[model samples]
Target: MSARFEELDWQPTDLGEISLRRRRDPSSGADVYEVKLDDDFLMSSLFTEGEVALARLGLAAASGDPLDVVVGGLGLGWTAEAAFQDPRVRSLLVVEALEPVIGWHERGLVPASARLVPDTRCRLVHGDFFALAEDPRGFDPDSAHRRFHAVLLDIDHSPRHVLRPGNAALYEPAGLRRLARHLHPGGVFALWSDDPPDERFLSALGEVFQDAEAHTVRFDNPVLGGTSANTVYTARTPQP
Candidate 1:
């Protein structure tokens, strides 16, 4: 019953109040962890195929070996952890806007916390993804102008549906151009969308990168019945 649910953690963020909770997922009849931004659900441990796909698809599409990666959001740590599955991934940098979300991982409060904290190849950077992308200094403040072989993002729900107003620019032309500057030649950019592939967004990516495609990741949605799907949009930078 819902009465058995527990709020694991809660903190106020610049975007909103973020909360982590453990509750019964009626569809699966199991307890699942959930992350919420104020009243809106941000991520759930119940469905993570798409999140994992973001890292897998991106790294696979990249052109080089011993890849360096940057993940835009650290939502339950699924995407970041997934990146490590590839032996080619030499290093991983996760940039999260909310400090509380990072704290959840550091304190071993999230599902993927154990894997992330002990992984020497993985590092968590507390900063705004959008700002870091736009900055000439790149994602890491100490290491300026660093470029990665793959950049995977799972922040906003979609290009049109953003978590915050400033995030909207990230999907625009200028923003995309700035982001591209942070990638190695023929590097990969992958994004996870809760919605199906947006043709317009795909077209925009096509214009910015060399090859672009939207891969559909489907999974059983016990609560909704039948099945549900998310989109992983991947593109590669131009080769030098």
Candidate 2:
């Protein structure tokens, strides 16, 4: 059996102290990997249904084949892994603010890291996602103003509850409009939220894109002995 608890990596970043830890789950008898920013629990391998669903639902809304995708967070690599499962995805650009998190993947410290690091289709970029979204140059560094078929985001806790106060702007109408410019017509944008669906946020999305809807992804929580839910908000650019 693996050690009861092991902290694989820790780094102090501008965001805060970020750490990656692995622990044995007594109930499942499996090792669980977790990422934390300071005292806030960011992601746990045990509860990744929402993250996977974010990619699945977002890509499902996309209309074309050979999709190019941009994922805004690289926590544990679940979202990017899930996106790669779709054969239609030709390329994946994952924008992460913390360089340490990218190093974790490159060093193969996380479960999905081994698969993600060797894949030529995946490119992990160290940059601020929100800042990139607002930039006219967009997510791709080499290709300016590049557009993607889908953008799956799991960075903040929710539209209202953000890790950084500056991130809150991305949820606003003006911010959403800025992000939309980086999408091709009929492209999709999906976001994962720890909180329940927020109608006000949905309204803001409606202003920026067509067919904006919120999906509640629920999963069993052994620790709570009940079900827990997270929200995935999906929106698509207007088709010509």
Candidate 3:
């Protein structure tokens, strides 16, 4: 029997009306959880290869034993959950702009949320990622001096495309520098892009970091009956 479609949560935020729903994928006959912001589909459990890869590839860049990480988006908690899979991760702070999205995870409305809440390594922080990145104090308000091993971001679709006007600066030269301040030397900065590898963005990243590259994560899209791909832009801070 196929799972029936239903809306699980809904709320209004500074951005727009956001919602979460669960439904059966007609083509694959599998239950899928999805989050939508306004009219745009933000994320879907059915296709989360890129989200998972954002964490995996980002963590790979870190050379330290105990890793401190920050994930900039909490759509469905898949990325944060994947971060925990690496036993080397000592602490993970997920910074989310939307309150409802964080609430969904705390309420156990999302599958990955169940795993994230019980894990002592993880904590969700409700705040503007851009603001925090630009601030000299950084993401962790409690510990202003704390630096992360990696900063995995998946909030915006890509550098060329953003949900808000303020976010455009985040991919620019000045904004990239502000973000780099939060990372330790040789730390990783990875971002998930819906579009394929963007050379222009990588060039921008290279200007700020020591080494920058894009990893293309391909996965089957049951709805499209073909393979689709997303880009994970990984960059490493300079070593002192």
Clash count for candidate 2 is 0
Over 48-122, each residue of candidate 2 has an lDDT whose tens digit, in order, gives 899999999999999889999999999899999999889999999999999999999989899899889899999
RMSD of each: 1.8, 0.7, 1.3
Q: Order of all candidates by lDDT, from best down to worst?
A: 2, 3, 1
Clashing pairs in 1: none
Error of model 1, residue 19, in angstroms: 0.4
Q: Which candidate ranks first by lDDT, i.e. highest? A: 2
lDDT of 2 at 90: 97
Order by TM-score, highest first: 2, 3, 1
Query: Once superposed on the true structure, which residue ranges of model 1 sit more than 4 Å away at CA?
Result: 1-3, 26-29
In candidate 2, which residue pairs clash?
none
Residue ranges of candidate 2 with Cα displaced over 4 Å: none
Clashes of each: 0, 0, 0
- Evaluate residue 6 in candidate 1 and report its C-alpha lDDT on the 0 to 100 scale: 90
Better of 1 and 2 by TM-score: 2
lDDT of 3 by residue, 164-221 (tens): 9999999987899999999999999999999989888898899999779999999998
- Relative to the true structure, how large is the alpha-carbon lDDT of every model? 0.90, 0.95, 0.91
